[model samples]
Every structure is written in structure tokens, then in C-alpha cells.
Target: MSAPFRDEEFESAWRELDEPQLEGGWQLFTEAMGVTIYRRYDEETGLYEYKVLGVLTSCAPARCADVYMDLEYRKGWDKYAKELYEKDFSGRSAIYWEVKYPFPLSNRDYVYVRERRDLEVDGRKIWVILARSSPETPWDEKKGVVRVTDYRQSVAMESNGACGTKVSMNYFDNPGGLIPSWLVNWAAQTGVPAFLTDMQKACDAYGDYQLRK
Candidate 1:
């Protein structure tokens, strides 16, 4: 019924990343391809929350944000996206996404609400997109699919003058099933960068995709 996440939560996240520090239990995980990632462990859930900062030198901030929010375009580029669509719950809109998993593992799915904001602070333009899981949804769970109950993702973008867009992302999710610790660690260390690389390529191609449409 109400907003999935509070306005203060988004503001706090953006403010913490404004200067970008490694305090508050966040440890540096890896740095590659101009992206720096940090992870924090959740004691109760035994999951990790990741924070990443990078620069996408291929496009402007607004363009990057547009590509990130475009669900139709995502189906073409996102290899893991098996099924994706949007639905309206009462008056609020939510997204349904099913992600592919390796053989012998069930697919993971998510139902969440997302919001995008274009803001100006101190004469600098900023774009932010926030998403979090919604427990109440109209869609019934599909057999053989593991619905992720705990998921949150946020992105903050700003212009980099002549370079491109400076981006920061925070992510966490719990795939409900028996997953090995090694596999989770591997995904965190390797998967984040791989996704970012794919996103950059998608941004570069977005202009042509729009022209065709």
C-alpha cells in the first residue's frame, strides 16, 4: 500500500556515498575495471550487502539511468533475465523478474517496487533509482522458482563533466534455498564486476536502440 522504502532511507544512502567512506563495518572486497566494491555481513541473515562505485565513461548520467530503468531493453542485454515485466498493484506499480540459475538449481525470482529521482543539489545534477522487495503481491509463486524475499538495490548517478557518469550502487538479496558459502562468495567477488561490464556495453548501445524504436 505505502511506499516500499522510506524517503529517509534513500537520502541516508546517498549522503553516506557522497563522500564515500569505508567505515561502519564495510570492508573492501575487490577493485577491477575502475569499479571499487565493498561488502558488509548481515548477522541475522548470513548474507552480504555490497556497495560499489564506478565511472561509466561511455554515456551521460541521464542516459545511464534511462538504460538502467528500461525493462524492455534489459531483456535483450541481461543474460540472466529469464522473465521480466511490470504490474500494477492497486495504484502502485511493481516489477516481476525471474533470473536464470545454473543447472540443477532452481531459478530465483523477485517482486519489487522501484522509483527514480532526478535531483539538483549545490548546482550538481543527480539521478537515483531505488528498489526493494514487496511482500504483498498479486502474482502467485510459480513452481520450481525460488522467490527472493529479501532484496534491495539502489543506484546513484551524477555527471562527470567531460568524462561520463559517476555511479554508485548498493545491493543485497537472499535467494531462498541451500546455497553453498563458496558459491555465494564467488558470486559477490566476480558477479558484480561482470554485471557492470555488461551494463556499460548496454549503455553504449542504448542510443541506437532508441533510434530504432
Candidate 2:
């Protein structure tokens, strides 16, 4: 479980990735309406899952964004169909969004990224961090369907300085169609954008309060 120690090929490819590559990846993601990323390896269950996250940053100030997807794992993908996702928070609720999952396996290949723009909110710039993750999944060439079974959560954040973060995510399921094509598109256009806008509003209000307090 956990992708066979990330294999030699994967290790080599990952090693080749530098900070520039990471920044490029961030830039590409920000520019796209959304994208589908496929991988094969679930270390915990020995199954593969497909994961997708979408974005509509062009409508940032509008706060109209969406993100969502499903996880299918062969080991027990069917068993996880009815499972639910959640967000966890505690302490200093006004300053940051703290989240976690009850099940440990839900933690893997988590992608965290965010973008910032100068806004009129109290005449300052605040950064937002949108986060997402899916249990790693290995593709099944024979069946042509990736399987996954895991829970995931997303959060949003904003910073007073250059280092703070904002995060959030949108997720859904479509079992019959091989892959949830429509859901992916909807998430890119609807879920992520809306939630991100909410995060910004929250940030502006909270940031002002924090500054005053």
C-alpha cells in the first residue's frame, strides 16, 4: 500500500521536478478551467483511483468557483460508495481553517495551492490557499476503469503577510459512467469558485478584524 515505495521510475521523475516545475504547475493550474490528473498507486489498499480538481480563477472577485471528484479503489472501492467527507476545525477559528480526517488512509498525494490578487478590501493584498487530495490510485489497463475508496476534505485560508494561506475543495460521485465527466466540469465552474469567493469575503472581514484587534 502507498505506491510500492514510489517505484524507481516515479522516484526518478519526481527527483527531476524542481521548484520551477512546481511553480509552473501552479501557474498552469491557475490558468486552466480545470484538469484531470491520473496516477496508479494506492499504497494502503493496493488499488488505483482517479482524481480531478477544477478551478475558475478568472471569476475570482465574483467568487464563483467549484471543485469536486470521486475516488475509486479496487481493494474495496465499492464498500466506500456511501462514505462521507468532512471539515475539521478548532482553536483560533478566526485566523485559519484547520481540518483533518478520522481515517488515516485519507491522507495521501494531497495537493495544496493558492493564488493572490490585489483587492479593494481595506486596501491590502491577501493570499488564498485552496487544498485538495485523493488516495493514490493505480490505473487498470485491462478494465479501463480506475477504482478508489477514500474520504477527502478541502479548506480555504488567507494571510495578513506574504506567508499565510487559504484553502477549499469540491467533490462528488458518478458510479455508472466509467468516469464522472459532468461532475468534473460542474465542479470547475460551480463549487470551487463559490467556495473560494466565500473564503475571500471571510478573509477580508477577518483580516480587518485581526488588524484592529
Candidate 3:
């Protein structure tokens, strides 16, 4: 049988996070139950990207954000973005927060980065695609899990400057497991929003702060 999971190790990762990341900008840390995404954004992309560093716990319950930028400032997101909201968002639990915003992307600029996907609860699938003017690397290319699931979907978005924003959407559902069905179901439905909202606030604050100064 598998050994019981421990949270102590995960907690240590947060403590080890560099405090220098929080200088000059704002830092917000919120928790639901089992997940916590630390974020930092500053005047420099290096520091803004570095602030929200690493995936602490790699499981179905994790998500992270990096940086990327839009190349054309004049080009709007009207074509790329259709609608932004959460379908399965749970209002009763308050675990999921829906974030909707139309952020303009600067013309010919790559000022933001994206995070690697980490988490696999069941046959769930994780994916990341960067909207760049030029071809680079696929953001979702990582280890752990593959094969996108049938009944799963979630999208996350953020803008860090005048142009360019990154949106990451993942869909998955963990069914038929040893763990309590309710617990698994709850997390499967709620994890995406909880993680995405934290990222939104961090990026928004950091972006605005950087622009002001």
C-alpha cells in the first residue's frame, strides 16, 4: 500500500521562498485547504517571473504561472479571446473565483513568461500553450502525466504589461479512486479556479505596479 501523504515538506518550500522577491511590489497569499501558489511581480520581468518560482507539490492539486508578452500593442485580444469564466465554479464553497478581463497585448513584445504544468490526480490531462508571434517551446511539455481527459476543462489568464497576456486552461476529473469520492470530486472541480485566482491577483498587482513606476 502507498504511504500516507505528509504536508510538512510542502510547507517548508514556502518558508524557503526568497523574501527579496516581495520588495517594491505587493504580495498576496491565500489558502483554501491543501494548495498554496506564491506569486511576485516587479519592474523587471526577471524578478517578476522569478518571484513566482517552482511547483512545490506535484499532484492533481497544483498549478503555477510564469511569464510571456504580446508582440503587438495595437493588436487587441478580441480575436484570440472569446469568453472568460468558470462553468463548474462552486459558489457555495467559495473555493473557486471566476476572473474575467480583456487585457491588451503590446505589439511585437515578449515581456511575460508561463509556468510549467504539475499535477495528476487521475487520468486528468494538463496542458499549456503560449500565444507568441514566433514559434518557441510548448509550455505543457513536462513529465508525470499525459492524455487529456474527457469531462474536464479550466482556463487561467493574466496581463503583465501594455501588451501580451498568458492564458492556461486545464481539464480533468479523477473518478473511481480509493480516496473518498466526495473529497476527490470537490478538488477536481475546484482546484483550477483556486489556483488561477491567486495567479491573477499576483500578476495584476505586479503589472500595474511595474507600469506606474
Candidate 4:
């Protein structure tokens, strides 16, 4: 059985991911693809987590939301996706993602459950999409691949005046083993921009791709 969704626990995540405070230790990391990125060090995990916010220019919220829901298209823009398939009812899924590492660094793989829900935030509607690795799925020992165990991620997007969408997310995955903190930091530093860039591209191409179908 899936873990019960505790109201308070989710509420906490909602606040952190949706109503972020860009104050204090949250430092600006990068800005690109119309996205602004921020990060803060977490002493508990010894990892720097990321907070990203952006608006996809001229893109509707439904389009942004649907692009995320449509898994196949994800394979095209997401360079890391190896396979994406549903494992159960609802939006629960298993995504096999391959992380591209520089020469001599072992690539990584993550098998996680990505779930989504539409809910109200501050009287406005938004989509709360969450993902994390499931313990039920045992780690496959693949050659030259490191398994990511500690992972938690969420994307929260709300419509902007019916014309565009405001997107925000928090992503962190602890790739177990001897991976250096600097490398992890570098990934977080660069990954956010690429993700938002592709998302915007996907939003732009989605319409044309459908018209031809």
C-alpha cells in the first residue's frame, strides 16, 4: 500500500515549495531560460538543495501542466530520461532516469514514483507534482550506474492571468557512494536552467506537434 498522505506533512511541503521565502541563506545560484534559481545548504543531509521559480512566456498553465503529465514527450526534451512508464493507477509512476556524467565518473539512475494532484493554494488553484524513490522497488545493480536513494522533489505551477504560468520546484537527490559534494553542487547549479529551458521549449512545440497529428 502507498503511504497515507498526512495532511500536516503535505501542508508543510506545500508551504515550502509554494510559498518560498527568498530571504536569509537562500542565495541566488543561476538564471536562465527565464528561470531564477536559488539554493541553501542543509546540514542534515550535507547537500545543497535547490529552489527554482520562473514563468514560461506566452504559455498557458494547462499547456505547462499537460506537458508534465504527458510522459512520452518528456523523453524528447529531458536528456536524462531512459524510460518513463506508469506502474499503477492514479499518477503514480516509475521513471528510469540516467544521469550523464563526465568521463571517468559513473552515471547514475533513479527509479522514483512521480505523483500529481490539483489543489487550491491561497484560494488559487495549482498543481502539486511530487516524486521520490519507492522502497518496494529494489535497486538493480547495473554496471557503471549509481543508485540514488535519498530523493524528494516537487513542482508547483499556477496560472498567471490565464495567459502564462508561474512554475516553482524543489529538487534534491542524494546519489549514494563517493560522489563529491562539489560535483553534486555543480549538478544542482546547472540542472535547473536546462530543465526550465526544455520545459519552455516543450510548451512551445506542444501545440504544433498536436496540430500535425
Identify the candidate with maximal lDDT: 1
Candidate 2: count of backbone clashes, pairs at least 3 residues apart or interchain: 39
Q: Write the per-residue lDDT of candidate 3 for residues 1-213, one digit (tens) a residue.
A: 112223432222223322322444535433333333333443432222212222323212222233212212102222322222111212211011111222331111111122223323253332332211111212221232221111222333333222333333322222211334454334433443454444444444444444764
Q: What are the runs in model 4 whose C-alpha is more than 4 Å off?
A: 1-4, 8-18, 22-25, 88-93, 121-123, 180-182, 211-213
Task: Give every collision pair in model 4.
Answer: none
Alpha-carbon local distance difference test for all models: 0.86, 0.29, 0.28, 0.73
For model 2, the superposed segments whose C-alpha errors exceed 4 Å read 1-27, 30-148, 153-180, 202-213
Query: Where does candidate 2 have its weakest 10-residue lDDT segment?
Result: 91-100
Query: Could you tell me which 10 consecutive residues in candidate 4 have the lowest summed lDDT?
Result: 1-10
Question: What TM-score does prediction 1 earn?
Answer: 0.94
Output the worst ten-in-a-row residue range by lDDT, candidate 1: 9-18
1 or 3, which is superior by TM-score?
1
For each candidate in turn, the TM-score is 0.94, 0.26, 0.23, 0.81
Which model is ahead, 1 or 2, in terms of lDDT?
A: 1
Give RMSD (Å) of candidate 2 vs. truth. Answer: 14.2
Worst 10 residues of 3 by lDDT: 89-98
Q: How many residue pairs clash in each candidate?
A: 0, 39, 26, 0
Number of clashing residue pairs, candidate 4: 0
Give the Å error, residue 113, model 1: 0.2
